[model samples]
Target: MTTSSYLTVKALTKYIKRKFDADPHLREVYVKGELSNVKIHSSGHIYFTLKDDAARITAAMFRTQASKLKFKPEEGMQVYIRGEVNVYESSGIYQLYVQTMEPDGVGGLFVAFNQLKERLQKEGFFNPNFKQPIPKFPNTVGVLTATTGAAIRDICTTINRRYPLAEIVIYPTVVQGENAAPNIVKNIQLANNQQLCDVLIVGRGGGSIEDLWAFNEEIVAQAIFESRIPIISAVGHETDTTIADFVADLRAPTPTAAAELAVPNQHELIQRIISNKSRLQQMTSALVQFERSRLKKLQNAYPLATPERLYRPFIEKIVQLDMQLGRASQMYLMKKYNALQKLDSTIKSHSPKNEIQYNYKQINHMTDLLTRSVLSLLQKKKDQYGANVRTLEALNPLSIMTRGYSVTYKEQQVVKSVTQLSKDEEIDIHFHDGKVQAKIIEIHEGGEK
Candidate 1:
């Protein structure tokens, strides 16, 4: 009942702190619970509550201990903790000082992986458009991995065996633990700066997620994304994927696969070359045969093969006209001769020497005039036929093309107007002698009136 028996908050707090420190069970404790009211301070300390259905305990992980954690803590996250129970003297409250903590019955790293994956997915880190094309024939292949491991061995062996021509550049890297992320990023930058390799294979042999964590680091992912050289990520087994895998230009299932992807197989390439050579030869032969067939068809065409057939009608017409002219001339001469005979019979009854002489002179003059007129008519018909032939020659299509004119066609159709064409369209210009290919650069829709 005495005031002396009653303890002040400070005194009670000190007693509790000392008592907790002294007890061996409180000094080293184990706890399993769900996290709540989690707060990460600017000073790098984490404050949270460890709660279950029964009770709750206030807990804290200091900067030094928090730095060693593999994953971030969050609200409602189930975790297992190794810590010491103690009372905070200043606050006069009991709290747990966490030394180490991990997710309960689940991997915290996996949780972290999912969170980062979601975030980066939203930021388009895994966009296929951002990926660069891997070189089919790489002169040099850069390998980023631990110098002494199965990963390096497998990669080097595969590359050397498949494509002996490619030079391998090895970048020794730490693939695990605290310093692995930064080291991976540095080597990636170094490889880019050196510009020695056409492509890069970055990875290690299959292992636990913890062992492959360096590839999952954001810095490593960013480095791979920024690399000027195309990178093939081969971090772990086929089933394992990382942030680096998403960001890299390509991903291979394993180290050996990465090497296989980095350089082409010499045997396969040789076979391809041989196949292509055969194909080219076959194509050339086929093309030659096609052109020959086309030329043969042209040679058999009516106009080119039998040019005389085209002029047969004209020749027949000319012959008929000449025959008509001869018949008309003969008819005129016969009629005049008959009239002369009748006149002679009549003149003989009243015949005189002077009269006969005058009639003979008149007959000579008429015969001479008839011959001149028939010759003039034949010459005029010949001139008319010659003029018609000249007109046909002027209208010949081949004759017109012989001038400086050319015909333009787009996609095998005659290009008559600007509306039928568009920018960047390819056209063929045919001249009398040959054909030329051209591309349309600009288009103006209207034409001259």
Candidate 2:
């Protein structure tokens, strides 16, 4: 074969590309498949493999198309794509250049559901701590659903059946379609603002994923999370779950179940009340009986039965105290009398009357003694005087003269010597009886003369 006749790898690839480009079916091809080996580029291009059970095809979506996607594509995600199928020349590969993409069937919704759930879970929006406790017996239940939907009817009927006392405030809202999420959020806010209901049941009846998609929306979930009142999520059948279910304070399998959760069964409540009343009656009767028994025991007690006995000991004690007081008073008086007697005796002992009398007697005796002493002394002195007088009389010159002896005197002095006389001097001669003056005419010397 000629060298030009044999096709090169580039030529073969270009030929395939041209064939694909020429085919109108391949130009705007629609495909449904599961995504695999997904790669999101920094430039916002998505590269992945579209696969079914039997085969797979490489696919790519540019930034423009990828930006339009409402949900992120991931591995094993089923998607419906409208795009051009062409062959690349570089690696000689055939691939789909996706222009538009959407999730296929329930798989897309599941992806969105899982993605939002994971996101909210990470943000703690679904945390149990943020959940408010549903009232055990709500006085009012606010219903958020379509007015004509079976969910509202079920909720209302169920609540009425369970608890007739619970009032129902209905908030007619669109529970599906694009407007559903915003409407639900608005209703939640309105209910909170009005403060009309104690609890809220946000829900709808059974539906497909697309039909129930509003309940899965982030805004609906956020509204439930932000509600001040407790929310019960009753989105669908028992098998169906939504984002509202995770963020709500409580999740019920159905709207009827939500109503049941919101209120207590009246029959059961009545039975409980009856039981409690019986228990209270029995307890009160027992308490009264116990109190009566206690009172009877008290009444039979010695102090209570005979109240006088209670004070008898005190009365006896008072009588005894009175006797003791009397005895103490008598003893005190006697002691005072004794003290007075002693005081009188001491006063008498210290009395100036007796002392003065004794002192007077002493003074009289001393005076008498002094008088006797003075008399004796006087008598002795008188006797001495008499003796002295007698002696004096005996020694008297007159007496001597009377006894034939005389005193000679000169100039009125007694002359003791014979020389006392001078010739022609005046002299006095004295005797015991008289004295005479005379003139001496002669002098006589004594023995010497």
Candidate 3:
């Protein structure tokens, strides 16, 4: 048997890769399928599987191409991919190298719009708190639209007619085509930097969605959102709305409406002035009549009609005060006179002669009573002294000695009982006339002698 040489896996993979690369048909292919396992790597490259009911294929998009995509690819989303087919030698797998990808059947512009809207919304660009209010009556209106377009003309005409005082500063901008978004952004920045206008009107005449797409761009939306000058977005017709509208301070249905909003109507103002003048005249006449009636009433009032009426209470108060003063003076004088009389009577009662006579009478009466009380007290004391003398004589121990009684003491203490004396103790016998020293010979008990 003849041995045939076979190719290695690496060699076979490279060979297939080269074949796919060289083929004009496979070099650039457009395929439609549902995305699966979509992943965006840290390097910004995207890898996903594109599969249909029949077959599935792996696809990769490099960072550069993937960056151009306006929307993120989600798994199971239907997509149309334009790429080259190739094989990776390391993995030995065939894959699609994606150059461009978009949602199936949907316009790329709409996708971009939705994506930017969603992203900016998440970042709070469409936050109502950031929205500025358009000036009701702008002194200078800055219009960012094509100079030759109907939008400018309408705005200028409306402003000139409605508010002739307002100065219109036109920042001629391209509002359509490729340069439209950048031009809009530039003019907005310029207008803001220049500080030329109180209010900014950014718009174009009514147009198709394509012509109006510039206002929907992220750059335009960001510029409008960041501008300190209040912006009114009037893109396309009333039915059309753009990202600029959502981000701007205000959105006008049309350019003319934007102009009208920026200024007040001159005719309306004039009519208001006239109506105010009439109201003022009516009010002034009414006020004058009211004041005149008030003056008449004041003149006819009691105080104004009779000048003395104002002073009547003061006059009556003075009369009453005078009468009270007279009465008070009389009462005070009477009280002082009565007090003087009482004092004079008191002085008279305290005269020296009368005081001496009164004291002498008191002394005489007291002396008489003292004389009788002294005699009675002396008699009672005499009787008490006699009674005490008799009591003493009756209680006297010397008297009892004269009656043949005596007291015996041992060691200077009176002995009351025979047992009190010791047999050999010295004692004294006290009698009425003498005290005799003696010795206790015996102590007698009972009747023994």
Candidate 4:
């Protein structure tokens, strides 16, 4: 090969780029392999190797395409990458510039993510109703993450910069692997039980799904759900999402973003409070001014404010009251005078002297008539009384005895009938002249005429 006859490195690279762009098959291709030696760039680009047991290829994804990847490609993660295969003459290396990538054969991280997502969702951890709203102005913020991670540093720095008034309480926790989940869960529960914070930030820096799996654990999700205080989940970069995100009261895309969300900017809040206070003072002053103006208007319109204006009306009312009182008194006196005149006329017509003489004359006539009639009635009553007395005296037994009549009595009773006498019945006989002892004679039946 003659080096002078061949193209230079830049020329060859340009030619290869043109060739790859022109060839549709080479421009859009699909490849499957396991990822290795992955290095993520600050510019968001990713460089790695795609290898199998038999072959390997150097791969690259620019920031745009790398940002679209759902799962992080690591040293041993299987993935399917779609991109153009091209030659880079600078390093004389043949590589794949990936456009899109997905897990190869359903990566373990993806499977775990889906499985945990479904399980937590089934357990109601992702229910919107269970979410607690983050406090707008948190007094204290509890952070559950590694003490050494950049996540806690970034969060603390951002919170201190934005809201210096809020207390930053770090519940240091392991943020990866098996022990990470239990530590995270314990910190969350401890934060809640202690009531140390008004809001909680459970998060860590971005990592592969395996590195971030602690946030996806059922225990961590349950701990977040059971927290009485609101939780903001910030586990990864903007594109990175986790089960903790869905179950959290609020999901911030990054730890810095979560810090920005956790509390208001102190300067802005103080400005707003001052503005409101000024507005309230202004409104109160305006209200007082309005009331004062109204009072002034009322005072100007009131008769008491101008006492001379009331004199004519007051004098007119007094004159009218005097006329009414005069008319009422005249009417009262005239009524009394007429009543007295009528009484005097009645007294003249029925004087006591004439009434007494007339009454006396009527009483004298009635007395004479009553005396004559009473004397006649008394003589009749006296004659009747004497006749009744004489009859009563004649019918008396004593009177009969005095007339030579006698009555016989037995057992102190007069025997007026023969049935009253019984044979051999001893009895005392009582005659008109005296009493004697007697016995009943036999053979007396009914021979009396």
Candidate 5:
């Protein structure tokens, strides 16, 4: 018989690893159990045990998977883990590898809180619209918390130290446990209804999730949201968050911080007021100096200093004008007088008495010569007139009538020859003295020959 060679341990382990990797159901599984013997390694791996009341199985979470846990896994903590059940192959032992884990009971509560937060945010309950501004100088501060807790004492001490004048009104209520949410909401409403303070601080000291759960209640959140007064939420430490923190107008990291935010320091406020008063005094002094200088300048002005000095130039100008007017009137009178004197001299030199005497002598001599010339011209004219008259008388037609001559007319026209007269025609006869109408009694062909 031929003897087969035995597989080495390394080869057997490799074969087991291969079988584990090939089995999909063995590679991945989820286990729910209470955790035990929990140990965190320097490399961030977690070694623990997952067991029921009767049985137990070893579990390991590598650094990469362990780092993702929201809450630290402690001994006796119940959790749900998702990972693989695989053989280590070196030790020939099978163990569960945890890839993900969540706190068995708290995880559901966390999920519910997140869902509500998202819903409230979407509905604008946490919007800036609902956020009241903190009073700059709160005279009275209202605190809503357990009357016996350290949170209230811390707040009162901080407020007293920073602003002594501030009056603290404590609205005592339970800050934790089952009845805490209703008490908190009622006290917040009472504070607002009383209008007893300028600002409100609603919070308590830090604690675990279960202890801090009252602040995360919806009733507490709604009370904070409906507050007319500004509210500062200081429920827990910086790492702890509550619904009140989201719904409050402002959030402070601790109870002492909330008190600091509530009131102003009296010393700093007094310093600022003093600084402002000093500035006002300085401005007043400068204004008074400016006005005084202006008044002095007005007093130094010539018109205000001496009224007569302002009118001196006008008086001098009027006097000069009067002197010029006097000189002009005198010059005009002298010119008129000179013109009249020349007229008087010209009249005396050419008098009408002298002119009349010279005219009389010239007239007497001219009259004698004119008389002789007139007599000679008259004699010449008379002789010419007689000769013209005789020439006219010789050519007159009436001379023929004076010598027994007459004229005969036919049809009112003179008949110079016998042939011109017509037989039995009306005729007219004209002598030197008168004319007579007639008719031809016979016809004569020729002049009597």
Candidate 6:
């Protein structure tokens, strides 16, 4: 085959992309499908897969168009897309270049409203505990709304008619369209920074939901939530609610109602003052009468009427205490005298002359005991010495010799047997009193020769 008969992958991809781009039917198409694998890049592009029951196609939404979207695209959300088909030359894959996307069965705005509401609710933005209480009587009231509108007129007229003392500070704001949300947020923060108002009334005249969308923005809701001054939200006619209504410190049905809530009615206050003044006068009169009666009772008291009656009990108590003190002194003196007499007897018993006599008696008794003990000990020692002398005499060899037994010695050694002596050996014999020397004539064994 010739080279011209075959096509490279790049050539094939270019041909397919050209076919996709030139076709009028594929140039701008509308599709309804469920989203899958949705990815919102940090660069503001969204990449996702769009699928119905039978088929799916890859899709990409660039940042410029995506920024215009009212609601965020999420996985599994059924959506309608108006876009053009194109081929990705790098991978030879076809994808839909999304231009505009909206939720399939509902308005995108409604979806966005619910999504933001649920998110802010979870973040505790709508908690009642964070809500500030509106002032019953404000010195200054701030109005945040369109400069030329019935809302401003109604608020100013209502506040002036009800509470004339309160000063009104009007902050002109954009209450509709694309620039409205940021403008409203700016005025809210500005009023807070000025700190000029005791309470702020933020509202606009009733309109369609699109005309009232500025109040539903998250930034506006955050601004209302963070404001130090209490905010009364009058967004629309009674039935229309916005995110600002939920986040504000208080919500009013209309601008006039918000003004009434901000400050108390002057006529009501005057009537209340008159009623309280009458009640206070009655209370003061009753209190004065009660104090006068108490004074009269105190003046008529028995102790005050007769001054001497108050001190009589004290004088009697002093006399009784004196009598008790006298008795105590006499008892104390008597006890001291008895103790002195007992001490004198003890002193006499322990006299030095008596102590000396007792010592002499003790010396005599000790001498007698020592003499008896020494005599008994001397007799015991004498008996023991005599017994020892008899035992020594019994063990003496001389005594044994005297009993007819004698010891024979040869060469100064005692001869125990006849083998100790040889024939004609000289020998010595020890008797009871003396020793004898003799010569051994013969030797003997077993007493025989």
Candidate topping TM-score? 6
Model 5 TM-score is 0.46
Task: List model 2 lDDT by residue over 1-449, tens digit each.
Answer: 88879998888888888888889888898899999999999999999999999999999999988875657897887788899998878888889999988787756567778899999999999888898988887889999999996888888899888899999999999998888889999999999999999999999999898899999888888888889999999998999989999999999999999988889999999999999999999999999999999999998897787899778899999999999999999999999999999989987777678777888999989999898899889999888988888898877656667876777866567689867677788887776678778887777675644
Model 4 alpha-carbon drift over 4 Å, by segment: 1-104, 304-449
Tens digits of per-residue lDDT for model 6, 342-378: 9999988787897789999999999999999999999
Model 4 local distance difference test score: 0.86
lDDT tens string, model 4, 49-137?
99999999999999998765545566787887789888877786779999888886776467667867876788788888878777888
**Candidate 2, clashing residue pairs?**
398-431, 398-432, 401-405
What's the ranking of the predictions by lDDT, best on top? 6, 1, 3, 2, 5, 4
Q: Residue by residue across 1-449, what tens digits does model 5's lDDT show? A: 43457778878888888889899998779889998999999999999999998999998999998765545677887888899988887688779999888878778457546766877788787999779999998889999888887899999999999899989999988988778999998998899889989999999898887788888777888888988999999988988888888999999999999999999877888999999999999999999999999999999997998989889999999999999999999999999999999999998888889779999999999998999999999999999999999998987889868898898877767787877766788888898889898888887565543
How close to the true structure is residue 366 of candidate 6, measured as C-alpha lDDT? 100
Candidate 3 residue lDDT tens string, 1-449: 43447777787888888888889999899999999999999999999999999999999999999987767888888988899998888898989999999798897767778888889999999898998877767789999999897889999999999999999999999999889999999999999999989999999988777788889888998899889999998888899888898898888999999888888898999999999999999999999999999999998898888999789999999999999999999999999999999999998887789778999999999999999999999999999999999999999878888999999988788888887777878889998888999887776799797
- lDDT (tens digit, per residue) of candidate 1 on 1-449: 98999999888888888888899999889999999999999999999999999999999999999987767898999999999999888888899999999898778788778777888889888999999999988899999999988999999999989999999999999998889999999999999899999999999988889899888887887898888889999988899898888889899999999999888899999999999999999999999999999999999998888999889999999999999999999999999999999999998878698887999999999999999999999999999999999999998766788998888998899888888888888999999889999998887655534
Query: lDDT of candidate 2 vs native?
Result: 0.89
| lDDT of model number 3 | 0.90
Clash pairs, model 5 backbone: none
Task: Give the range where candidate 6 is weakest over 10 consecutive residues by summed lDDT.
Answer: 440-449
Task: Report lDDT (Cα) of residue 405, candidate 4.
Answer: 69
Candidate 6: residue 138 Cα off by (Å): 1.4
TM per candidate: 0.65, 0.58, 0.67, 0.47, 0.46, 0.70
